[model samples]
Structures are given as structure tokens and as C-alpha cells.
Target chain A: MARILIIDDEEQLRDLLKQMLSRDGHEVVTAFDGVDGMRVFNQFNPELVITDIIMPNKDGIEVITELLCRNPNVAIIAISGGRRAITAEFNLESAEMLGVKGILSKPFTRDQLREAVQHALGL
Target chain B: MAIKTKNIIDFKSEAGRILLTSMGALLLLMVSAVFLSSYLETQLGSFKEVVFLGLAMVIALGAQWFLLKTIQSPQVLSPEERVHTTNEKLRHILNSITRQVESALGIKNTAVGGIENPADMLAATLIQCVAIMSEQVQSLLSALQMGSNESLEEARQSFIPLIDKTAETITQYLHVSQNIDNQLRERINETQQLLLNLRRELATVPQNQQQDTSQLFACIRQMGDVLETHLLIDNVVKKQLEVVTHDTNDSAFTLITLMRDLSDQAGNLVRYITETISKINAMENGVDESVGYIVRIGHFIQDIPEKIQRDIQAIQSASGVIDSLSYLVDSIKEISFQTDILAVNAAIQAAHAGDAGLGFKIVADEVRKLAVNSNKAAEMIEAGLDTARHTIHEGLKFKFLEEVMQQMNEAAQMMDSVKKLQEGHEDMRQYYKTLFTVINQSNMKLAQDISEILGSIQYQDIVRQRIERMQAAMQRRNELLQEFAIQLDVTSGNNMDDFATALNAVLNGYLEEESYHGNSLNSSDDGDQPPKFELF
Candidate 1:
């Protein structure tokens, strides 16, 4: 089992992801945004991180950059439900350009999440 | 040897000696009586009878004394010798009786080797010994009836050993039986304690099971609540998607219509500018022709005064041409004004299109500026026409052909301004074409964005399906837990096989559903594509 951190402004999606990952025997922690996520990341020292792109305080790109700076090998999976003129593809592509371990569009399935997590963790 | 001889009589030897002595004395008496009888028959017969009777009495007395002395010799044993002899006899009788009892009971070998259920064996041996004793007692009674003192004494001594042996056997049997009884009681007590412990352990099973069942029920309730929340979230997301989809579709349609209108307006404005350019070119040609005629008129007046009237008619014709050119300029000005109005309307429509029409709006502004420039050129041409018309009428009224020559210069300048206006109109036409292209590209991008938005809306349905699957699994789990709870309440038996089976079935069902849904979600169905994921 791996320790994972999830950062997202959507409470429902965060909780849902937590439940799904927890069922897979992983220890999961959640944060409301990138700011809280970073704080939790330091304290939790998780093996993997799953974050949403668009959020209130801080966004996924900033979080990915900061985490990569701290530990370049840290596994990160970026997820996004694009807003306004921005598409999820664009958001994910941007995160991918930053060298994230994995990317997923919003409303992803459990299997998809599991596969991404496996890929990120190199399992 | 002495004690044995003293205590026991030699009855056979003594009886033989006594019989021999009695017979010999009787024979002696008989002989005396016969001799005397024979002599007396001759001399004294009565004296012979008296001598025979006296000799027989003497023989009987001698026999009695000899038998008494022989029997009395053994009867004189010492008291100590008698007791020792009796004890020895008793011991011999006891040993013989014990051997008989052991042989009868088949216990001699068993006693040496040891036996199971010794108490039972001892009791059976004691019973058999008593039977032997009974036979001995019957023999003793027969011996007493026969008046045999020696046999009676031997029977009495044997009976004592038999009675004592039976009593000892019974006591040993009792001791063995008591030992067996105590062992049995200890085992019974141990068994009772074991049963009490088992009962106590069993008593706690129901309580512990009840607690576990309650915990299971609570978990089931929690799952139910989560399912309900998922359902609510699904509904809300779906409704929100519907609203967003509707609004996006309406906006897209409105934007498309507005773009179409703007494109048509741009096309119309380009066409108008083309026509206005042609009109301005034709009017410029007319102005140049009029200038040519006026110059010729100046030359005619210089050459001959007699041709002045002819030149006057020429000047009049040129003035009429100038009048028509003024009308053409006015028409061009009107077209320019119409183009300006169209540009302003296109700009308003572009503004309504928001961000997508920003380029279109810029082009519209350019078009409006061109229209304003066209109007300024039209006013310049009309003013030039007025100058030509005023110069022609002055030349005709004053009869001075020099003023008409100056009218030619002003007309040439007006022709240059008209040519410039025609060039400006040409530039406006190209700008309008570029604007149309910009608008077309913007509209295409907008349509694509709208399609993407429609595709993104499918995420809601996907989420709803996932939630529904979870709800189904939760419902099944709850049902199984309820059945387990009922089973617990119904029976106190620790039969958990049924509950375990049911629980496994529920878990398997949930896992199967999840796998099926996962596969379905990953599978492509027509235009329904799986979610995009990437490992970078």
C-alpha cells in the first residue's frame, strides 16, 4: 500500500477519489487546494499526489512545479475539469508539459484512476 | 515327633493287641473247664460246671484291664502339646481350603499376575469360597450323625479356616470396590467442571455476536448514507449539465447567426464600395472630358472672336456635363453613407458575439473608418464639381475665357481627388474581404468549442452511472447484513457458515459489478469515448 495525497476544490470529487483509492488499500489524505496540499504533502510525505488543475487558492501547475522542485522524482497525476474557454485537454496538456507522471480528465473511472496510480507509482 | 505321638493315638495297633489278649484268655478258660469236666464226670460232675463259669469271668476281667491301659496311654498328652497340635491342624486346614477356593475361582494365576477389576474378581472368589464352606459344613453334619469324634474334630477345625478366609476375602473386596468408587467420583467432578467452563464460554458467544452484528449494522447504515449522498450528487450534476448544455447550445446558435449576418453585411459593404469606386471613376472621366472642352474653348476664343458663340455652346455642354458629374458625386456620397451605417451595424453584431468577435470588431472599425474617408472623398469631389460648375457659369456670363481655363485646372485637381477616392475604395474592399475571412475562422473555432462542450457534458452521465452502481452494491450489502442479523436473532447456534457464505456472495457481487462497470466504461460504444488518461 502507498500513501497518497489528493488536492481538489471539489469536495465531492475529492472524497470520491479518496474512497476509491482507499478501497484499493492505499492510505489517502485530502486537501482543498494547492496551498493546503503542499502543507499536507510536507507533513504526510506521501508517495503519490493526485491534484486538480483549476482551484481557488492555487492550481495544479503551481503545485506540480513546487513539488517537482522539492523532490523531482515525486509521482504526480494531474486532473482537470476545464472551465470557461479552457478545455480539459488543454489543462492536462499543460500539466503534461511540466513533466507530471500522469494526467487524467475529470469524471475518470475507478479503473482509470487505479491504472494511473499504478503507472505513477511504477507498479 | 514326641508331640505328634502324644497328641495323636495309635488306635489301630492298640485295638489289635486288645482283641488277641481277650481271645487267648477265653481259650485258656475253655481248656481248664473241659479237663475238669472230664475228670469230674468220673468222680465229681457238679464241681466241673462251677470251675468253667469262674474261669470265663476271670478271662473277661483281664481283657477289660488290658484294653483300658492301651487307650489311656495316648489320652495323657501335655496341654501345650495339645494346643500346638491343634494350631498346626488348623493352619493345615486353612491352607488346604484357600487352595480349594483359589482353584474353584480360577484366581490363583490371576492373583499372581494381577487383574483388572480386582474388586469384582475378589467378590466372585469370596462367593465361591462361601459355597465351598457350605459343602464343608454339610460334611461336618454328616460326620456328627455318624458319631465319629475324630472326623467331627477335623470338620470343626476346617470350618474355622473357611469362615476366616471368607471374611478376609470380603474385606479385601470392599477395599477394592471403595477405591474404584472414589476414582469414579473424581472423574465425575472433573467432567462437571469441564462442562461448566464450556457453558460459560458458550454463554458469551451470543453477546459478542450481538456486538459484532450491531457494528455490522452501523457500517451498513453508513454505506446507505453514502449511497444516498451519491445519488443526490448525481442528480445535481446531471441537472447542472443540462442547464449548461442548453445555455451553450443557445449561445452557439446565436453566435452563428450573428456571424452569418456580419459576413453578409461585409460582403454587401465590399460590393457597395466596388460600385462607388466605378461611379467615382466614371465621374472622373466626365470631369476630364469637360476640362478638355473648356481648354479647347479658351483656344477657340484666342484664335477667332467669330467662333466665340460656338465655344459658348461648347462651354454650355461642358457645364451640363459638370452638372451630371455633381449628381454622380452625390450618389457616391449616399452610397458611402449607407456603407458607414452597415459598418456600424456589423460592429454592433460583432460586439454581441463577445470575445470570439474581437477580430471582427476591429475589422468593422476599419471598415467604418474607410466609409468615413469615402464620404470625405465624395464631399471633395462634390466641392470640385461645384467649383467647375461655378467657373463654367461665370465664364459663360462674363464672356472671359481665362476664367474657364482656370476651371480646367480645378477640374483636373478634382479628377485627381476622385482617382484617390477610387483607390481608397479599392483598399476598403480588400479590408472587408480580410474581415470576412477573420469572422469565418472565428465562427468555425466557436462551433468546435461548442461541440467539445457538448462532449464534456457526457461526463455527468458517466458519473451518474458510477454512483448508481455504488448504490446497487450498497443495497445488496445492506440486504445481506439484514439477513445475517435476522439469523443471529433466530438461533443461538454458532453456525456462521451461512453468514460467511452470504457475506462472500455480496462481496463477490460487488466486485463483479465494479469490474463489469469498469470494463464498460473503458469500452468504446459508438461516439461514447473513454476518459482520456496519459502516463508521461
Candidate 2:
């Protein structure tokens, strides 16, 4: 099982991810904002970080940069949900540049997340 | 590959004749083309006589006649004839489908007058369902927006519980945060008062020490010593204050972030509710389309039961003629699938039997195409009927409707809970803000007091220490004055006592009467000073 950190401003979404991912036997930790996320990330150094793109006190990109700076070997997963559909989301190419190991659009199913994680880990 | 060569009407043979006719036309065409080419060449100065071209054309025509009866067009249906004929049959198919639609859906459909195409009829019916459902979906969405207690009859029944669960979660978090706010405010208020008390304790000294010779001198000496030590007290106080202020600031930041998070949670709930309702709509629409497709399937099955019985009689009558016709035995059997199939097959074979079968073959092809279409229509009708029966049987069951209505009601209840929870969360946010403002104002006042005290303490220490030092050195010299100005008691030690006392009296009076440069910090030793809660 992979250890995962979920970062989002929405607590319910955090809860939702926790329920879904943990039921698959993955260990999950949650943070509600970018700063707390960085703190928890540094402390836990979880195998994977699943973070929402929009946040305060340093957003997803900033967090990714800081995390990778601390440990370049770290793997991260960034996600963006349509706060509005047809609007620009977290750019996939940009996330790749920031060392994101995977990206997902939000409200995704378990199979999609699992498949992406498995592929990224080469499992 | 029908092997029947019986006068299965020779339309193809007639087509062969038509090809012979076309071959005759091509010969004429070739001759004209050569003549025209030679004429053009002569006009362009390339030829004087066209005799060579005329002689060549006569030879080609003679050759074309033999080509005619030989290969010619094999007795197949011409592409143009096939299209013209199929268009006529397709119109019939369209009419049949429209009738089926009429029988099944029972909607007020126009004659589909301009719509001769089968695809258009099908599309029109499907569009009918789509348009109807679109209106219903739009109304459902509007009803949801209003959150009318009774409007979303089915959905409200299902979604309410889920919304309630979400609302409960939000309320729990809000209460927790509210508790934290209350705790923090109390602690900060206490800290502020303590700071004020500390300043007062450090400001004054005891009153009795003002008049006492030894104690006054000792107190002044201690003040001189503490002037340096007081700088350390200032530094420690300043640092402790910084730590408190920093802690409060960090907590405030956390509180703000948490509040925004709560807002975000509320927003997420709203969005999720919208998405869920939309999904239900899409699902419901899908079910409705399935209903339409089922109706199409019913149209397909309606023909199967009646046509099969009619075909049984045709087969019996055709069997007798089959042996005499010899080659048409297979063709007759082919038509066993429908009344038209055998006719079409007979027509095709008759045409191939030279000129004799030509007329029959044309009829046979038309009848065969019609039979094929009818078979398809039968299948489609059967499928539609079965679909209608199965869908109605499965979907209209009491349990299914009950379950759907139950789920919808639960969803509605959940939505209500979410609304209430949002309102409660908003209140929580306001309470935090009010508490936050109070704590913030107190911290500011505390900061101001500490700042003023700290700023004044530095300057006060500098000036107070300088004066106390002067007072300490003068008193020590006064002890020296008493010793050096003592009257000579060598002649009679007892005799000089009066003189020493009188001089001491004179000195005490002068010292007591002297005025200081400014108002004293105390008229007497400063009241009720703490011995231990003193400077440090």
C-alpha cells in the first residue's frame, strides 16, 4: 500500500478522498491548507502527495517546488477540479515540470486514481 | 446464387437486350466521335479528305454488333434502376415506421409529409422524447434552485439524508473551532491584565525607607545597582512579550485559514448537490430514451406473428409449379420466407432464360427487395414490442418505483440539512470573527501598554540612576563630614559632647530643610510595594 497525503481547502473533499483511498488499504493523511501541508509533508515524508491546485499561503505549485527542493526524489500528484468547467485547470505540462508524478481531474473514480498511481510507480 | 433457370422472369435478359441496345448506341457514338474528330482536324488544316475516318467508322460498327450478343451486360439490375426502385420502397418503410410510432407512442404526430426518409422519421421521434425531457429537466433544475419543499417530489425524498450527514459534519467542525476561539480569548485577556499589574509592581518603593538614615542610604544604593540590572528585566520582558504576540499572531492566521476552509466546505456542498441533481437528470433522461428505443422495438415485432401464417399458404401453392418449372424449384423455396421473395426469385430466373423471362425478372427483383425490407420491419417491430413489454414490466414494478422515490426523498432531506448546516456555519464564522476582534483589540492595547512602558522605562532608568548615584555618593561624604568636623575632645572628652551635639543639630536642620530640583516619585516611600514581585 502507498502512503498518501491529501491537501485541499475543502475538508469534505479531504474526507472523501480519505474514505475512498483508505478503503483500498492505502494510508492517508490530510491537510487543509498549503502551509500545513508543507509541515506535514516534511514530517511524514509520505510516498505520495495528492494536492488540489487552489489554496492559500502558497498554492499547489509553490508547495510542489518546496517539497521537491527538500527531497528531489519525492513523488507528488496534483489535481484540479472544475470550479468551472471549460476553464483552464492545473496545466499538466507545468505540473510535470514541477516534478508531479501524476495528475488527475477531480471527481474521478477509484479505478482512474488507482490506475494512474500504479502506472506512475511502475507497479 | 439461385440455380433456378425456369422462366424466372427474364428482366436481366431484357437488361441484356438493353445492353445490346446500349452497345448499338455506343457504335453510333463511336462513329460520330470519329467523324467529328476528322472534321475538326480538317478545319484545323490537318486533313483535306475525311474518307479515312468514314471507312474506319463503318468497320467499327460491324464489329460492335457481334460484341452486343456476346458479353453484353449480364442480366443484373442497373444501378440507376436499383436506386429509383429502392427510393420507392424506402418511402413505404418510412410510412410503416410512422404507423408503428403512431400505434406505440400515441403522440399527436403530423403526417411526416415532407419526411419521406426513414432516418428522419426515426430522428423525429427520438427528438420528440429529447425535447420533452429537456423541458422536464429544466423545470426540475429550477425547482431544485428554489428548494421548494414539495416540488422535487422524488428527489427530495432520496437526497435529504445524505445532505444531513454532510451538514452534521460541518456543524461538528464549527463547534470545535468555536471552542478553540473561546479558549484563546480568555487566555489573552488574562495575559493583558497581568502585564498591567507587573508594570505597577515595578514602579514604586516602600514609604518608611524615605526618612530612615540607614535604610534610605541602603535603598538609594540598591537603586544605583539595579539601574544596570533593570536593563536585563527590560530585555526579558520585551522578549516574553514578543513570544506572546507571535503566538497570538500565528493562531490568528490559523483561525482565518480554518474559517476560509469552512466557507470552502459549504461551497463544495452546494456544488456537489448541483452535480448530483444533474446526474439524476441524465440518468432519468437515459431511462426515457430507453423507453423510446423500446417503442421502436415494438414496431418491429408486430408483423412477425401475422406474416408467417400468410407465407405458409404461399409455399403450398408454389410447390406444385416448382417441378414443371424445373429451375424455379429453388426460387419458389426462397420466397417461403415471405410472399415477395419467391416472386422476386422467379422474375430473376425467367429474365435469364433469354427473352421469355425478361418481364418476370424485373418484377421478381422488386418483390425480393420488398420482402427483405418487410422482414427487417418485422424484426424491428418484434424488438420494439418486446422492449416495451419488458421495460414496462421491469420499470413499473412497485418495488422499483418505491426505491427510486425513497432515494430521492433521502436526497431532498440531505439537501435540507445542508442548507441548515450552511446557515449554522455562517453563524459560527460570525462568532469567531467577533471573538477574534475582541482578542485582537486586547492584544493591541496590551501591545500599546507594553510599548509605552518599555519606551519610558529606558529613559526613566537613565535619569533615575544618575540621580540615585549622586545621592549615594553625597551620603557617604556626609559620613566623612561628621568624622572630620568633630570638636577636639583631647582636653576633656566629656566637655566637647555639647559642642558635637549642637553642630550635629545644626547639620540635621540644614539637610532636612533643603529642597530638591523636581517633584519626587513619591511624597513618602511608594505604597504597598511587593518585595519579590519588585523589579525582576
Candidate 3:
């Protein structure tokens, strides 16, 4: 399977995703937030990126702005929490605006993050 | 590039040769010209003054040719030389600027050592720097109008504004330097006030004799450009020496304070010692002394608490003593240095004292011996303090109040676990508050340390160390705004010629990726994952 990256602040969930992806024989890199997520994506040139919508410093919006400026070909899977937490949190519509191929919400089972990454990579 | 720059008149270099040649030949020609002209005017019976003047000019011209002519053809500057001359002037201007910058740098170095008195040194330094940097408007005219030979006219027209702009930078720095100096002076005065407060609380110091001496030295260190031009004054009046003196005094001040406080505490201990001696004497009296309250008092509940408090007080006093002694050693050294110089001055002044100076010499000798005794006693006190602290630390470190608190936390946690056995739930609340306070104190201390260390490092120095630190961070941030200002004035894009392009096609070159280390972000139009935390 092609390498995939997951960017999330939740350590527990990132760990779960890492385990599930490597089981599928794909190389997995995890980033804590949009800032490091973008940095890792640039350096590693990972075939696919799966990122969360909210982050501090350089947030998901900033990461998207910079990445598309360099290359438009890279595939992406976006996940969101919700506006119920804060109006700033990402929604499905903004993910569409950013050109994400797939979108998901939190409280999704292990099957969700894994299947999203697998589908985006065409594995 | 040519001897054209070397003119016969430029006595700045060959003054002696120019003076000798011009004075000798020119004077002879002029005198002969005047005599010939007057004689010819009388012969012509006024061929009018015009014709007589013409004949005088002719004779003067003939004599001047033989006398004033030189092998070098009286070198005047060539076109290239005009540029070099202008540049040379610019170099002098920059040199002056650099000297000021160096002085500022020197003062900055002094400030680097983390002393309470660096403010004074830095303020004086800024003043010197500003004087050097505060270029006049005339220098702007020179930097701008004085173009090199190749593009003299064009440079004169276009570069003047840049010179003006550079001048503006100097002016800005000057204003800032002055403001900073004022603020720094105020801060030093505040520090001096703090020092004065400590001294005042000390009560028994000889400040009347000593205060003026330090104040005078402080004034000398604060000398600016007027002092800097005299290279010796600027060079000798270093912040480093001031800082060393500062460090020595700081240690000594701390030493004196701690010693005084501990000595008072030692008096308290001496009272207990006297009591113990009285108890033994009472025992020897054998007057039914089985009910001696002193030994019994040590075992009582209230007495145990009092004894523990006393022990803690003793430890605090011991720590104070150690601190005081360290400072005492340092202060003594600095004062001795000051006194030595004063002594030398006095001795010189003593030579001129005549009979009246004998009494003053005696006073000086006494002062020196007093200084010696102060230094010796300070050393002994410091050694004693160090030994005492070592002994106290051995007994106290593990069993400090924190250990007692830890046991309380353990009992509280246990009690909370078995809350059903308790009559009230409010007991757990108190424990929680106590724990919170401790944690909050710990965090506050950490924050204080971070602020102190980072804030203490000068911002400009860090900026100079690596522009990339700020620039790189800014660059990353700039990408978000999507409008990073690329200075296009210099225009450093691929300057490929037509032939080069053709050659490149022949060689089949390919485009390369830009390296930005790990600073890469894939297009995540599909947002995923949770947000991360990063401090600003």
C-alpha cells in the first residue's frame, strides 16, 4: 500500500490509526497538528494525507493554502469535529471548498479513519 | 590608479617638500616681476600702466617657468581618482560609524554578564554610539552626490535619496539610543536606590566616606563620545571592569546582610546555651532538682513544636550566613581595589602634604589596616558559613516541610478513598485546595525562570546571530498570507542568455525541487484529525 499520513491532536486516536494502517502494509506517518502535518507532508512527499480541520498556530486552513500552492495533485481525506464545539471548527462544506476527496466526522469507529485513508490512496 | 591624485599642493602627505619648493621659487619670481615692471614703466614715461604691467607679467612668466616647473607635471586628480577620493571619504565616515558601533558593542558585552549595574554601562554606551551614528545631512550629500567615474552623473542623480535614507536610519537609531539611555539611566538609579536601601538598613556602614568614591567611578563609566574620542578614556573606562566591581560588590552586599541577620540569630542560640549551663549548675546544687523543667520541656507537645521552629530558624540563619559571607568576599575584594587606588593617590598627595600631611598619612594607614581586617574577617566568616550550611543541608534536605506535607496528602487521599467512613466530605475539599496551591506555586516558579532567562538575552544580539531565525519563521507565516514580499529591486532570477538557453536544451536540464527541510504540507482539502497545540 502507498504511504499515508494522519494529522490529529488526539494521541490515542492517532495511535489507533497508526496500528490499523500498518496492519494493511502501508507506511504511516502521524502529525500532531496542521503545522507539523504540513511539514511532514512536504518533506516525506507522502502519496496521501488525512488531516483534521482544527489546529493551532498554522491551522488546517493554512496548511491547505500552502500545500495547493506547491502542488494540486496530492490526494486528501478530511475529518471534522463540529461547530457545536466552536463556530471555528471545520464543517463538510469548507472541506469541499478546499477540494478534499473524502470527509468524515469524529466518534467514527476504527473502521472510519482506516477505510478513508485506504480509499483515498486507491488501495 | 594614477599619481594624478597626488598634487604638489596636497601637503597633507608631502607638506615639507611642497612648502620648500613653492616658498623658494614663487617668492623669487614675484619680487623680480615687480622690479622689472616698475623700471620699464619709468623708461616708457607711462606707456600707460597697462603696457608696463604686460612687460612685468612677461618677466614673471619667464622666471616662473625656470623656477616653478616640476618633473611630475603638477599632478591633478584623474577621473578615476575622483571616485576613489569620494570612496575614501565614505570609508572614513564608515570607520567613524564602526568605532561607535564597536563602543556600543563593548557596552553590550558588559551588559551581557547579568549584573544589577549594567544599566549604567549600557546607557553610556548608547550615548557614545549615537554620537558616532548621528551623521550630519552633509554626509548624506557626499554619499549620494559623489558618484564613481563610470556612472558619476547617473549615481549623483539616483543614489542621493539612498544616502538620505541611510541618514534617516542613523537618526532613528540615535533617537532610540537616547530614549533607551534615559530609561537605562532611570533603571540604574532605581538599582542604586535598592542598593541604598540595603545600605541604610545596615545601619553601621561607613557610607559617608565610601559612597562618594563609587558615585565618582559610576560617573566616569557613563562618559559618552566626548570621552570616547580620547581613545585612552574610552578604552580604559570599560564595562567589564565595572561589571567585575559590580559582581564583587553584589556578593559582598549579600554577604554582609546574611552575616548580620545570622549573628542576631546566633545570639538567640546563645541564650539557650546559657540556660543549659544554668541547668547543670542547678544539678550540682542537689536541691531536689529531679523536677528540672528544662529537660522535661523538650518532651512536651508544645515544646516539641517550639524546638522544631527553633531548628528551622537556625537553619534559615545558617543559610543567610553562607550567602552573606560569599558576598562579603566579593565586596571586600572590590573595596580593596578601590582603596588601593585611593591609597596610591593619597601617597602622591602625601608627598605634597608637608607637615600637615603627617596626620592624614596616619589616617590613611589606619584605613588600610581597617580594610585588611574587614577582608580577613570576611574570609573567615565565609568559610565558617560554608561549613555550617553543609552540616545543615545534610540534616534538613530530605525532611523539609514538603515531606510533612506529602504525608498529609497521602493520609488525605486515603481518607477520601474511604469517604463513607467519614462524617463529612468537606475535609477532601481542603486537601484539594492545598494541593492546588502547591502546584500553582511550582508552575509560577517555572514561568518566572523562563521569563528571566529569555527576557535577559538581548533581542538585537539574537537577531544578529541569525537573521534566519526571524526570517525563516516569518517566511513560514508569510506563506499563509500568500503575499511574501520578494524584493525585486535586485532581480536575481535566472539571468540566462540566449546561448545559455540553447546549451541547456542541448544538455537536457531539468527543474529541481526547493528544499525547505520538513516544512511541507500536503493539500488537505479534506480536513481530518484533531487540532494540535502550539505556543506563540
For model 3, the local distance difference test gives 0.45
Q: Candidates 1 and 2: which is better by lDDT?
A: 1
| lDDT by residue for model 3 (B387-469), tens | 77787897787555654675466556544434422312232222233223322332343334333322222222221222222
For candidate 2, lDDT tens digit of each residue in B1-536? 01122123345666777777787788789788979978888877555358778777788777776666454532344756544443433333223322322322221121111112232333233233323333433443354456542454443333333333433433443343333334334433433433332233223222332232333233223322222222222232233223323332333333233333323332333343444345435444544554555454455445544654555445434543433443343343444365675775587578678787787777787777777766666556556555655554554455446645765765565555555445445433333332233333323433443343333233223323322333333333334323322311122111322433443443343334322422222321432331111131
Q: What does candidate 1's lDDT look like per residue over B310-368, in tens digits?
A: 77889989988988888888888888898899899989999999999899999999988
A-chain TM-score, model 3 = 0.84
Fnat computed for model 2: 0.00
Which sections of candidate 1 miss by over 4 Å?
A1-123, B1-407, B493-503, B519-536
After superposition on all C-alphas, the RMSD of every candidate to the true structure, in Å, is 48.9, 64.2, 49.1
What lDDT would each prediction earn against the true structure?
0.58, 0.47, 0.45
Best by lDDT: 1
lDDT of 1 at B237: 26
TM-score sort, best first: 1, 3, 2
Chain B TM-score by candidate, in order shown: 0.25, 0.21, 0.22
Query: Which residue runs of candidate 2 sit more than 4 Å off their true CA positions?
Result: A82-90, B1-536
DockQ of 2: 0.02
Listed in order, each prediction's TM-score against the native is 0.22, 0.19, 0.20
